[model samples]
Target: MNYYKDNVSTNVVTSNCNYVVTVKDWPAFLNEYNNFSNTTLAAYNAAYLQLGGGGNVAPGVSFLLKFGAFLNLYKADPSSDEYMPLKLNQNNA
Candidate 1:
């Protein structure tokens, strides 16, 4: 044990850190979240379009973007949307 410790490292240390988070406005926060979602969906659409829609891209660019953004927001809030039902309806068989 002594030999292993000596060879592995000269010393060991522990970390002590603290963090604070602030969210002042709920409505504003939700608004900004959808704004961010819009930007992200725009990027997704741009990427998909860049690839050039050929076949089997899995739905249209706009729907796919909204679906993806919904997933991310649902992760944060666990709320409702059209795609949520479809996602929850998975067979799992």
Candidate 2:
């Protein structure tokens, strides 16, 4: 997820059943998450690379910038409602 300016945000969600599995056990959930991260990151990186570069930045630079900005915004105003209403949609079998 990424936050822009005061109240704007964006995110990416995968429809793959293997992603974001809901399990009661923390360890199992984390293990599944780790696996998903590896696959998702690889796919994202590939697609990002195909988009070419942005000026002096690399293909994945835009995503990194947005993520960094979001982190900064969160750090600045953690209690702000601008970051609320976290919308998470799970797509899986």
TM-score of each: 0.24, 0.21
Model 1 residue 11 lDDT? 18
In model 1, state the lDDT of residue 56: 36
TM-score of 2: 0.21
Model 2, 1-93: lDDT tens digits are: 223233343332333211111223445445645765878787766654544352444312333332222232111133232332222123210
The prediction achieving the highest lDDT against the true structure is: 1
Q: Which segments of model 1 are wrong by more than 4 Å?
A: 1-18, 41-93
Backbone atom clashes (below 3 Å) for every candidate: 0, 0
Candidate 2 Cα errors over 4 Å, as ranges = 1-39, 50-63, 73-93
Q: Model 2, residue 71: displacement in angstroms?
A: 2.7
Residue-by-residue lDDT tens digits, candidate 1, 1-93? 645433331111223211112333445546757766878787755755655353334333323333333322111112322221122223220
Positional deviation of 42 in candidate 2, in angstroms?
2.2
RMSD to the true structure for each prediction, in A, is: 19.6, 14.6
